[model samples]
Target chain A: MSTYDPNVAPKVSNKPIIWSLFAAGGTVTALLTPVLVLLFALAVPLGILPAEMFSYARMESLLASPLIRLVVFGILFLSLWHTAHRMRITVHDFGLRSDGAAVFVFYGLAAIATIVLAVALI
Target chain B: MSTKTSILPVVGSHHRTLEVEVLRYDPDKDDKPYYQTYQVPCEEEWVILDVINYIKDNLDRTLSYRWSCHMAVCGSCGMMVNGEPTLTCASFVRDMPAKIRVEPLENFPVARDLIVDMDSFVEKLSSVKPYIIAADERTVEDGTFTQLPAQLADYMSYTHCINCLLCYAACPQVNLNEGFVGPAALALAHRYNLDSRDKGRSVREDVVASNAGIWECSFVGACSEVCPKHVDPAAAIQQIKIAATGDYFINFLMPWKKSKNTDEASSGGGK
Candidate 1:
């Protein structure tokens, strides 16, 4: 058991890990999100690509590679973490008090989504 | 018969009446603060401070506020003009609407009419040791510390802070957290830290790297926008954050190669 000492320096916040993830996710989204949106939403529906090319079997086969699975997980997990952190800060900026409930709701959702997506990919 | 036409003066070229609303309070007399309006006959080019002086000199001698060196260099005339923090000496009457609301700077306790208590601000500014700290003692017999043009340019932008404290009024985080070191003080700390001649980074780190220091700032960016001297205190705070983050990780990874003052800073006392 440790007693409280007023003289000790305040514990440094461990925000760098979440901040780094947010930065990486932001970079990934900036470079890849628009292209992904164009391909799946615009190109597929506008007859620019044959529908058979994006069939279920073909998509499953494309994602079956170990390298592709790793990339998918990286993008999905990092983006969720980024959005969670962003929403938490945004809520605080909008004059809402940040508390344990808000933290649990936002970061907890990101944690759960990461676990579920990891299992599905496996 | 030719009739002589009567000449009339132009409408707005002469003086105009400005409805100036000032928040007035006296700790000795009033139970709470209240707004007092004065109809000021203002010239087109007159600034808000001139109008306040007019009220003090003529209408009500009891009106109180701080101002000197009617120019913006003094930095004593900061107030809330029309819901925005501004230097009364720099805010022109011509640019404002006919009716203007003037109040004490936000996030500070009002001492009088428009004068806010600045003891906390002074304390914070001093805590960072906002001055040059050399590793070794220097003598006048030694030549003056000379700096190259490029080196001087590195921290020149942050040296423009006049301490008007408009950034403090604009920062929401400061309003929320009373102990947050605020903008001008942190920026001045960063300014000294960036100086080529100053080796006081280790000494100043105790305050700037403290939890109540740069780490508390959430990058509102309003401080930079409202800065009359274009000091960009927000940018200074961000740069300090990067440095602090690097220091945090470096200290964690290489504990044996730690810098001096690490033990002192760990004691949670300001030098």
Candidate 2:
């Protein structure tokens, strides 16, 4: 009680890094995921495009390039990270206080999935 | 030759009796706070504050609260009207239902009936050093500094915070974290930090950039909605997040540039 200075500031935390990634992931998912969904899921089935517009052969041709493979992987990685961070925040908002456990579990899943996807792509 | 128009109730034409339920507590008398109802004869054009005054005058003298400057400028009449933080002076009695529930602002200790203890709020306000801190003190002989209208416009809107604390009540982050500097204070901090004449961004950054500061805010945006003055503390906090992120990267890549300046905020350089 004697030495408590409320104004005495602590060192800046490392949350900026996490927040930056979360923000980037949020933007990437928001801008690209809807288009990806519309093209890959709804467009062909709803008769907006032909049935064989996104055939396995066409998919193979598109993924033939390493650059396109890297771009797809990058989007998937960011979207996964975004979902991981969102889940953690949503859990906290739902009145659960186990932030440490949530971070470990959520971010651990994202990291494990990223590695698995990377190896499969290889 | 006065041409002012009066909106007072003519005779008994526009009189409505309202059952106002107010949360009451007496520290010396009661162990816990409870509701006390007042049957108030509300006028046609009376705001919520006028209804409280009517109760105080005609119904209950013991009902205590804070008010001054009958306008919203005083910011003393902030309370929860139907679970929303409201400036009673600005909210019309006609807008509410027949039954009104009034309570002290949330996230603060109740001092008395409809009055909250503002000690913690005052402490938080001062922690940000809400003032222009220049590199050197200038005497009267130094004359006045000139600021362009464009520069003034940058931080003009933020200067309108009346310390009503509606933002504090509306924000869930404040309710959860006592250490986190609430909206009004952080908005004020940003107000000063944006001042071109100020040079103490580094001094303020120790507290402002901490975990309990703007980083604690998750951009729920409740503060912006509840702000009566439209000061937009949420926006201020988010802007600070961007600047702090820049500072974080700058500090990481070049530790020598740790001392941040107000003028060179790396904040896109304009309003």
Candidate 3:
């Protein structure tokens, strides 16, 4: 065997992926909350819809709609992608090698989370 | 054949050797710095400091250097090994081939040999008020404060700094601007400020407000890269900037009320 070793390469981890997922989720939630609140206020002033109708029931119903479902899926996919990228960085920062097993595991988890979220929304 | 007994040669008989050139400076005798060379035997496990020690012990007893703890701790043996800021004790000589160069830590006045004056580093450390301050001072009868694990995790990594000046040596900003507090000191300051039990925001006002504070860091990130402890001085400075920006807004809105209240309290006490 040659003296040169391939095992010395760095590895990535899952923590950064998890952190990025949470950060993206929080940011979207923050932005959407204010915009949704403002839209509800405007709807009441415009008299196109009743203010009280914008409740939990309306939100659940909206999620069941195809258009809303598509938006939700887009957000979830973006958040998961951001998370996976971040996790790779976090793993590398801790001096872990980016071995095939680590990459497989991280990508697998991100894929699973995204699929699960999409199914639930559907 | 019967007259001579068979003997085996040493396994490392053909091992490589290197010529190491080290910069020498003496304030008392030498008008300027000069280079000295030594031929050292190379082994995979040998670090630069090991070669220096060998040269000092066997070649020349008069040659001076500084070292402690041999490991990466104590931060006493930081020097430029082959133009890189490195802990001499931990830098392996075998990594370099044929030639090696060594010099004292940069961004400081060289006192003699490989030692640099550390007065500037100490002064910067003191400038940041690197300690916790409670909003209310408690008497001796009061018990010690407590903190949660999550709170401790915020600043725990920064506390690992062994005061190695490697970050300062690597930081070009510190080199250009002597007034800047540098990386290690700022990281330590962040350590205290981030403590959940510490209510010392008021004390850090002047430090963060000063031009020498976190503003001097241009996010070159060389400090974090050269840091042996992985303290991430760049991250600490960024977090401080976030807090300072928030504080600026709060001060602008409600400055007069607090100032007037303090003035009234002091005047009443004087009466």
| TM-score list, all predictions | 0.83, 0.91, 0.62
Q: Best by lDDT, which number?
A: 2
| Residues A4-122 of candidate 3: C-alpha lDDT, one tens digit per residue | 11222211112222343545665776777687677776766797777667778878888878889989887877667666655654564444655355658777888898889878876
lDDT by residue (B1-271, candidate 2, tens digit) is 7454765445445568888999999999999999998888887778999999988988889999999988889899999999999999999988989999999999999999999999988987888889888768989998887787878888899999999999999998778766678789889999988887777666777777787788778889999998889999999999888887877888889887776453475322533
Docking class of 2: acceptable
Model 1: CA > 4 A from native: A1-12, A26-65, A120-122, B1-13, B139-142, B260-271
- Candidate 1 C-alpha lDDT tens digits along B43-119: 86788999999999999999999999988898999999999999999988889999999999999999999999998
Whose DockQ is higher: candidate 2's or candidate 3's?
A: 2
Top-DockQ structure, candidate number: 2
Question: Whose lDDT is higher: candidate 1's or candidate 2's?
Answer: 2
Q: What is the interface RMSD of candidate 3, in Å?
A: 19.1
For model 1, what TM-score is found for chain B?
0.90
**How do the residues A2-110 of candidate 2 rate in per-residue lDDT, one tens digit apiece?**
1114856476768887777787789998999798899868998889999787889998999989998898888888888889988887887676878899999999999
Among residues 3 or more apart in sequence or in different chains, the pairs in candidate 3 whose N, CA or C atoms overlap within 3 Å are A10-A97, A10-A98, A11-A96, A11-A97, A11-A98, A13-A91, A16-A86, A16-A87, A17-A83, A17-A87
**Cα deviation of B172, candidate 1, in Å:** 0.8
The residue ranges of model 2 lying beyond 4 angstroms of the native Cα positions read A1-8, B1-13, B260-263, B266-271
Q: Candidate 2 — which pairs collide?
A: none
